[model samples]
Target: MDDTGRTPVVDLRLDRAHSARIYDYLLGGRTHFAADREAAGRILAAFPAAGAAARINRDFMARATRRLAHDGMVQFLDIGTGIPTSPNLHEVAQRIRPGARVVYTDNDPIVLTHAAALLRGRPEGRTAYVEADVTRPESVLGAPRLLATLDLTRPVALSLNALLHFIGDDGADRGHAVVEHLKGALAPGSTLTITHATADFTPAAMAEVGAVYARAGTPFRLRTEAEFRRLFDGWEFIGPGVTLSHRWCPDRPGDALRATSAEAACYAAVARKP
Candidate 1:
């Protein structure tokens, strides 16, 4: 702990392969280490469209954020925020609503190192970063920075893109329970947007990809369409409910048609609390 008595940030552990770093590597970011690159290589060999899948997932995030911001939602809570890439959540939200406030949470130390990029926002808006794990919803929900930046009583958009798959079911409803806990905390009209990896389209390829992640010490559980839909159980879906990542409000006219569900390998949805 520093003189402030708060816990110090953990080590980067560049030798270890973290799911976030591997995702960074797949997204063509330079923040990953050799370990992350190696794991991404294996995943690519198993599923050649892994990079495209990552891009599709990212596009889903931008679209969802824009839709929420345009719809007058001014606060955002993004958990499992990976390494900072251009057009971060704040950028997309603030573009539509300059007063939009965003709180990004992630356990990865590398994301903390690059937190500054996530914090640059318009003078009228606010952006904060909280280094916390999604598995411990209380840690994120109760964070001082989060509490200061976002008003829980107000409508906030929560995005969990490409994250829950890492939290494996374990036959105990692990990921689902986390979502439920977070959902219960938000006020009515708050939105929950998620993009999760699934094996429903190509079970063999996704299984091989999961094996690669497991070998890298990351637990990856690819859910089915039914299981993915269960994450947003009681929430009201916004548009094109629980479709393929690229198919969820594609920007271009034929963009969704160009990418097959097997190529995307992920499902995307945005729902609001009743």
Candidate 2:
């Protein structure tokens, strides 16, 4: 690791656009570079509510983490953790359960640079960052930091928020296969939380949005409601079944009213392994 805590061999790759950085740009974060900004602008043009959708997805993660922590879950494994946004998963989980142990995994090296921010949590809580890709479940599940911080035998809260869309279905790295691999590693009672982009609401706009990402060298597959729900097959839903991102376990009355389905453009749910 370098002085910045980033892996020496991991290239920042600022010339090309990365999905995580593009997401950071959409969330109005400063960690994004010019390539990410350019792709985000095109995405906004394709879907005017892109920024709102990103924010709604982020809120769902916080709600899911809080719900899991309140339900007596102390170990968390959050894959595809993007740039360190304030009130991150560890912050929300630790607030509810101060001793919550969180393992954050991401493929982006830029995220590795910002891992320090992700590591800072309440003294009683434990936070670790694993630089790995979700496509190879073993890389994340078997990470040293992850194994040291979380007990896979215990009930864990696994979150994959606004991430699966970047993984296409036709690749050898199939999205469902990867998810199933991770799910199979967890013990029963482990909770899975997901917020995935979908075309169930605005098909044409989402298709255009996908095209924008494709042009930027990123794969974006917007699943339908049925397809998204299938990702949680066999898991018992915690609250309302798969719903719009903003509609899932809304903390405030206005939270559900905050965004329309088309604006949120994402499906969210929390389910437990049965």
Error of 2 at 110 (Å): 0.6
Query: Worst 10-residue stretch by lDDT in candidate 1?
Result: 1-10
lDDT measured at residue 224 in model 1 versus the true structure, 0 to 100: 86
TM-score of 1: 0.96
Task: Report the C-alpha lDDT of model 2 over 1-274, residue by residue, as the tens digit.
Answer: 5333555787888898898899998998999888889888888998999999999999889888888888999999999999999889999999999999999988889998898999998999999988888988998888777888999998989999988988876755488888899889999999999888988888988888888788777788778889888889999999898999899889997889988989999999999999
Off by over 4 Å in 1: 1-9
RMSD of 1: 1.7
What RMSD does each model have against the real structure?
A: 1.7, 2.0
Residue 176 in candidate 2, Cα distance off native in Å: 0.6
Looking at model 2, the pairs that clash are none
lDDT (tens digit, per residue) of candidate 1 on 1-274: 2113476766988888888889988999988889989988989998999999998888889999999999999999999999998889999999999999999998878888888899899999999999888888998999888998999998889999899989866679789899999999999999999999988888998889888878777789778889889989889999989899899888897999877889998989999999
What is residue 96's positional error in candidate 2, in angstroms? 1.2
In Å, residue 227's CA in model 1 sits off its true spot by 0.9
